[model samples]
Target: MTHATTTDGVRIAYQLQGQGAPLVLLAGQANNHHWWDQVRADFHPARSTLTLDYRGTGDSDKPDAPYSTELFAEDVIAVLDRLGIDRADVYGTSMGGRVAQQLAARHPHRVAALVLGCTSPGGPHGVERSNDVRKALAQPRPEAARQALLELMYTPRWLDSHPGPHHTLGDPGMPAHARRHHLAASNRHDAWELLPDIAAPTLVIHGADDLLNPAANAPLLADRIPGARLELIPQARHAYFEEFRALAGPLVLDFLTTAPSRP
Candidate 1:
């Protein structure tokens, strides 16, 4: 475990594992570095992975302020700077993907490659969640909220077969205040206009049955980011990396390891 202090003086926690080229893993809203535990090994042997807790998640400082994607992006940059890493392949899921967009757009040189999974650009162009899911997410109680999240994240068959995975639903242990801030940041995030400015080799992956961030957003991301590749996993949902790690893992590994072809 390691710590990096952001420009705002918030201490962010991170972990470094495996050995090879640096690969940064960013988690979704209200999740921390530990969220990657299940898939962290997928990139081992060929790449060294860095997983960080975004402010307000994991062991990071939970400052009482409105969070934004730009803030999270800066936090990630701080982590890299603290570790003395000049460049790395960056991968983000959901809210983390939103932050990755900001990082690549704002500091393109730091990102050698980019991968976004089950995330949206936000704003009018992005898909909005259904009211039922939204209400469930606002359940106020931790257990209820976790249940709501599981329902929204996994398909029925996957949930039925893997009942134990429910423990992973809210494993980040985010406080209610911090979660509210994260949710606010997510609601306000808008990267549609900024996608074209990303210069790194990029890959966009999404689950075909994703509900939180519809799979339709994948094409928009792939098309907007020049030279970006898109891959859609069938019979998967929002947390495809965990629900279908067997399939999503290899696709991500290949994209991160292989060189991008010139257009």
Candidate 2:
């Protein structure tokens, strides 16, 4: 376990794995480094992986103040600085995707390539979960939120084939506090206008069956950004990267490895 101090003086926790060019995995809402566990091994022998738990999630210190995606992007930069990595390919899912885009816009020099998974550029109603999710999370019932999330996160076939009691999304398990923090941070995020300025080569991947954010958002992202490739994984959903790591892993690795270098 390693640590870095963010610009706001928050102690962020992260773990480094593999050995090669650095690749950072920024997890989605209410999730942390553990969310990348299933796919981390696939990047081996090619890219060193840096997975972080943003402040208030995983092993990172939780401050009471409200947080935003911009702050999270800065936290990611600070993590890279602590590891002495000047540039890295970034992979962000959901909330992480927001930070990834913001990072690319604000700190283009630090980012090499970008992989956005199951995410959207937040504007007014960007990727709002169903009202059920809002009520469930607001009720602060961890189990209900988890179950409701699973519905939108995975396709019906994947959920049916999988056994009972799905894997928890968060590292320490999803608690009410984490869910609340996620909702607040998500609401505070807005990165739609900045999409045009992202100079890094980008790959936008989404599950065709994704109910939470819908696969349509992928094309919307690719269409707005210059030279962004959009790939819709068939029969997959939001957490398909975790459920079908075999498929998602190679897709991302290839995207990073084969993308043309930036000028």
Candidate 3:
């Protein structure tokens, strides 16, 4: 584990493994470095992967402060600068995808390629989650929410084998205030106007049945971003990156590993 100090004095924690081209894995809202635990091995040896804990998650400082995708993006820049990596391929899921939007739009020179999963450009232009999906995600009790999340994330077939939800599901295990901050930041993320600013080759991939972010948003993103590609995993849900990694992993790996960097 290594720590990088952001300009704001927050100590961002990150883990780097393997060797080859750098690939930064950004976790969803309220999640930490462990977000990539399931699929990290799939990309092993083929690429060097880095995963970081966002503020208020894992080993990073969880101060009582407001958070935004823009700030989260800057924190990633701090980590990259600390490691002297000029540019890297980035894969971001859920809220991390929101931050990735900010990163690639705000710091185009730092990203070689980009992959966004199960997330959307927030605000008025973005599609909102269904009431049923919201109810499933918010069950009053944490345990109930976790249970509901499992159903919302994984298909019944996956649930037959995988009994429990990941610890990093929903707001993760963060303070109530920090969890609120994460949701707020994710809610406010409006990359609709900023989408066209991204210069890196981008892939917008999602689950066909993602009620949380909704698969319908994928086309909007792919259409807005110049030269971006769209891919949908059939019958998958919000957490397809985790539940359908076999398909999602290779698709993302191939795009990032082969896309030409900025000249």
**Top model number, TM-score:** 3
Candidate 2 lDDT over 1-263, as tens digits, reads 67999877899999998889999999887777877776787888799889998888888888777778888899998999998899999999988888898999999999899999888888774656667656754556777777777777776677788864443355555556656777687777777888889999999998888777767778888887799998888888888787778888888989898999995
Identify the candidate with maximal lDDT.
3
Model 2 lDDT-worst window of ten: 164-173
Model 1 scores a C-alpha lDDT of 0.87
1-263: candidate 1 lDDT, tens digit per residue: 57999888999998999899989998888887767887789889689999888888888899988999999999999999999998889999999899999999999989989999999989998878778777887798978987777866888888888786443454357788898999899999999999999999999999998877788889989988998899999988898998899999888888877856322
Model 3 lowest lDDT segment of ten = 164-173
Which is the winner by lDDT between candidate 1 and candidate 3? 3
- Candidate 3 regions with alpha-carbon error over 4 angstroms: 170-172
TM-score of 2: 0.90
Question: TM-scores across all candidates?
Answer: 0.93, 0.90, 0.96
The deviation in Å at residue 145 for candidate 3 is 1.8
Distance from true location, Cα of 14 in model 3, Å: 0.6
Output the lDDT of residue 51, model 2.
91
RMSD of 2: 2.3
Please report, in order, the local distance difference test score of every candidate based on alpha carbons. Answer: 0.87, 0.82, 0.88
RMSD (CA, angstroms), candidate 1: 2.1
Model 1: pairs clashing at backbone N, Cα or C within 3 Å: none
